[model samples]
Target: MSKEAQFSTDKFRLDGKVAIITGGASGLGFNYTKAMLISGAKVVIASYDEKGWDETSKFAKSVNGEVKFIKIDVTAKEAPDIIVNAALSKFQKIDILVNNAGMQRRNNSVPI
Candidate 1:
């Protein structure tokens, strides 16, 4: 065999990485945030819900992960710049982006 290593064990390791996760405060987005944080990446959670920040922050603390929260409606026009700036200011760089922001509404339908 050649002297090159075939596979290293750090596939999911995100040491020294920075991640921006849109809608990362709740639902499936929150799950992604937790995973990345646990993987050694500093995460910036861009969420519309201000309350979510508190909860997410607490969780980050529990796991001893670095996390920042920015309140922005991802659907708004200025949202992109806001999120990018937040991440840069906090972590200095962004290596991963989990663009998982989304919304859902349930409306009752009337029979025609």
Candidate 2:
């Protein structure tokens, strides 16, 4: 069989993996968190929105996979290191990182 045809159920599993998803409190990042949790990976969601953190974390917990929410501003230079440190502190290692946080300035002069 070809390599593409060799995929198996086990190959699709994320058991024992740890993932970090920026902007995971909402939008597409949240979707990725859900998929990772369902696939058996522990996820650390980094976002600036505290409001969505509670709700999103609740859903992730209901899936029976470990999840942690850390408030972060991804625009900061230290943000990446902070995220990695947090994830490492919790899960000891990071196997996946989804850099999904982004900002767009409005009216050309609006602050990001």
Candidate 3:
């Protein structure tokens, strides 16, 4: 067998990979964090809301993986740089970034 095939499982693992996920403290972002952690990738969860951080922490503990939370709002002009710096500070290098921060609200005054 070829070397590639021999280490297929190793290739699937994210042993030395780091991922940055925006709005990862809650909702779909939270789910993504769990998945990546289970896959062996260290994750940095960036969010403006600190409330959901507790949940993320608990999940991280249960999964026994490395996860960190950084406060950020993607709407701001400096948000990109802030996020990049945060990732670098924590993980040294960022291998993945999930731009999942967003909002959805219904205008009750408008008729459907």
Instruction: Give the worst 10-residue stretch by lDDT in candidate 3.
Output: 2-11
Query: What TM-scores do the predictions have?
Result: 0.79, 0.81, 0.78
Worst 10 residues of 1 by lDDT: 1-10
Candidate 1 residue lDDT tens string, 38-112: 778889988778767877888788868999888778888999999998889888999999999876759865479
- List candidate 2 stretches off by more than 4 Å: 1-11, 107-112
TM-score of 1: 0.79
Write down the lDDT of every candidate, Cα atoms only.
0.83, 0.83, 0.82
Model 2 RMSD in angstroms: 6.6
Q: List, in order, the clash count of every candidate structure.
A: 0, 0, 0
Which regions in candidate 1 have their CA more than 4 angstroms from the true location? 1-10, 105-112
Q: Per lDDT, what order, best first?
A: 2, 1, 3
Alpha-carbon deviation at 80 in model 3, angstroms: 0.8
lDDT of 3 at 108: 53
Q: Pull out the clashing pairs in model 1.
A: none
